[model samples]
Every structure is written in structure tokens, then in C-alpha cells.
Target: MRTLAAIVLICTATAPQAHPHIFIDTGLTAIVDDAGALQAVKVTWAYDAFYSLLITEDYGLDPDGNAVLTPDEEAQLRGFDMQWIEGFDGDLVARLDGGSLELSRPRDVTLVMREGRLVTTHVRDVAGTPAMAGHILSMKPFDPTYYTSYDVTMNVRVQGLEGCAIVRNLPDLDAGMQQLQGALTKLGRDQDAIEEGFPEVGEAFATEVEITCADR
Candidate 1:
């Protein structure tokens, strides 16, 4: 499991600056059934080179020094678990109408090295209510503590929606940084400062995904 402490050890920089220790370019695709009802979300996370190196070292991948993963290595890579952190919720948040949508443990997990960087792909079922026939669902993936930074450089895609459109509300980084500063200031140097302020202030820094359903 990847932890903040591991990142801190490798990066040697945490807190005060809040410069994201780990960087991931993210992509989201809405999975739809044959009848066009949204069933799940497929998320792709490509990690930066620096963090990729760290993960590679931690996982003991490519032990042969040939840069090719063995069958066991591949199994380990595919078995990387990412479940919600109890009360803290998970890094990805999805909501339909006024209620929050539950996400099953990540499935179809895959890990590969692309251009010397680590890329992971996985799908999470939209638990609770799955048929999003006529409702708008909003989603965002972010660490409320402002720990790891996520960026989406490409256009967010919607699969199986021939006529529906996608509208993305990108995060305002400047305003978000200011919000972080305020939260840090209020919490002072307490140990739990970032974690405590995250629930209230984290989403401000997340890229918003609002899917507008096509007319019935």
C-alpha cells in the first residue's frame, strides 16, 4: 500500500509548500449498459516519472533488471487494492442527485509502464443506485488533505453516449491554494491539520465532473 510517509521519505518535502509530492494525470470514462443507463466509472491514473520510480522500487517490480514484469510481478501489480479509507471516504467522490454514490472496491485493475511512467487502469461500480437514466451525476478525484495532486490534461470522455455532451468544471488552482493556506493557518502546526480541514476544504481543489443526461 502507498502511504504518505513513503512519499515523504522519497521526496523529502511535505507541508508548508504543499507542492504535490505525487502527480497523476487522470482520465474518467462513464460506463454505460446496452440500454444507455450509466453503470460504472472507469478511471485511469498515470503517475509521474518521479513517483513511478518510487512505486517501482517499493513493489520490487522488474527484479530481473530487464524492465519486464514476470508473471508474479504482474499478479502483484494487478492486485493493488484501493478501497475507501473508512470515515475519510475514498479519493474519488461521485454523487447522483442529492445522495452520494457508493463505489465498490476497484475491479479490473491493471498496471503497466508507459514511456517510463506507471499507468494504472481500474473500474468502480456506482453502488447504491446504478441506473442513472435521467439524473445528473457529479464526480471528482482528489485528496482532501491536498496531499497528492491530480491533473487532467486531455478531454474527459463519455462512452456509449452518442448524443449526450460532457461539461467539465476545472478546478481553480490559485483560489484553491489560497483556501489551503487559510486552512493551514487556522489549524496551525497541529499534527492533524490537513486531515482535519480536508472534508470541508478539499473539494474546492478538485476538478468537477457534471454529466448532463440527454433528454428523455
Candidate 2:
């Protein structure tokens, strides 16, 4: 399991930057059935090079430092990030009509080292088949505590659905920063933000993807 403490320590020692200790380039694919009902979503995450290095080192893999893992090493590295603790939401939020959509745990997980970065993919099945003809579906990936930042830099697409358009909504960074600063100010300079309970404002800085389909 990847603990927050371990990630914080690694980031503090390596980067020394405040909040957003790690960065991931994210990709999301919404899956739909023939009836245009949402079925699942495939998520892909590519870790930043620095964080990838730390993970490789921590796992004692890639001893050659060539970023190439043997088949056995690859097997060992599989699911390194999917060991979710209780209550962890896998950093994904999906909603329809202002109501939260329940997603199953990650499955069909694949991990590999690509160009010195750790890239992983997983599939999360939606609880119920919700038709997308007349409704809008929104999805975002983020860590609530802002310990890790996720950017939807890769592809966002809908499969098995026609006339569905995907739109990427970029976050307002200026506003998000202002909100963070305000929350930090409330904590005071002398107080440890983490110990004082850092505010969950990650969604304020997240990129949301919206999917809508034309009437059939």
C-alpha cells in the first residue's frame, strides 16, 4: 500500500514543494453499451518522472536504472497503486444530474514502465447502466487533500456510443490558488497544515470532463 506518510517524506526530501507532492497525467475513457448506457470507465495514469523514480527505488525494481523491468519484476510491480485503503475513492469522481455515481473498485489493471515513467491503467465499472442520451455525465480525478495533483493531459473519449461529445473543462487556477491561500491563512503560519487538517480543496483545481450525447 502507498501511504501518504511515505509519499510526503519522499516529496519533502526530493522536491520540498508545498502540497501536490506528486503529479500524474491522467486519461479517461467512458464506456457505453449499444443502448448508449454508461457501463464503465477506463482510467490511465502516468506518473511524473521523479515520482516514478522514487517508486522504482522503493520497490527495489529496475536495479539497472534502465527503466526496464523483467517479466518477474513486472508481475511484482502490478497493482502497486491499487491497494486502496478503506474509504479511498481511487481519486475519481463521476456524477450525473448532480448525483454521485457509484463506481466499482479498479479492475483490469496494467502497469508498465514507459520512457522512465510508471504508467498504469485500470477499469472501474459503473454500478448501474445509466443512459446518456439526454443526461450529462461529469468526471474528474483528484486527491481531496491536494497531496497529489492529477491533470487530464491524455485522451478523454467515449466508446461504443455515437453522437456523444466529450468536453474538457479546465480549472480556474487563479481561483483555486486563492481558495488554497485563504484556507492556509486560516491555519496560521505557526501551525502545521497537515496536523491542523489541511482542507480538501483538490476539486477546486481539478480538470473536469463532461460527456453528452445527442438524442438518438
Q: For residue 55, give model 2's deviation from the true position in Å.
A: 0.7
Candidate 1 at 186: error in angstroms?
Answer: 4.4
Clashing residue pairs in candidate 2 are none
Q: Alpha carbon lDDT of residue 75, candidate 2?
A: 81
Query: What does candidate 2's lDDT look like per residue over 1-216, in tens digits?
Result: 124334434544422225766889899998989888899999999998889999989999899998877778878989999999988999999998768999999999999888988899999999888887878999989999787888888999989987878899988776776766566556655667677776787888888999888878
Candidate 1 clashing pairs, residues 3+ apart or interchain: none
Point out where model 1 deviates above 4 Å: 1-19, 63-72, 81-88, 128-130, 186-200
lDDT of 1 at 52: 73
In the range 65-167, model 1's lDDT, one tens digit per residue, is: 5555655666676645354466655478888775788877778888877776777888888764356557777888887665677665545776776555677
Q: Indicate the residue-level lDDT of 214 in model 1.
A: 67
Number of the predicted model whose TM-score against the real structure is largest: 2
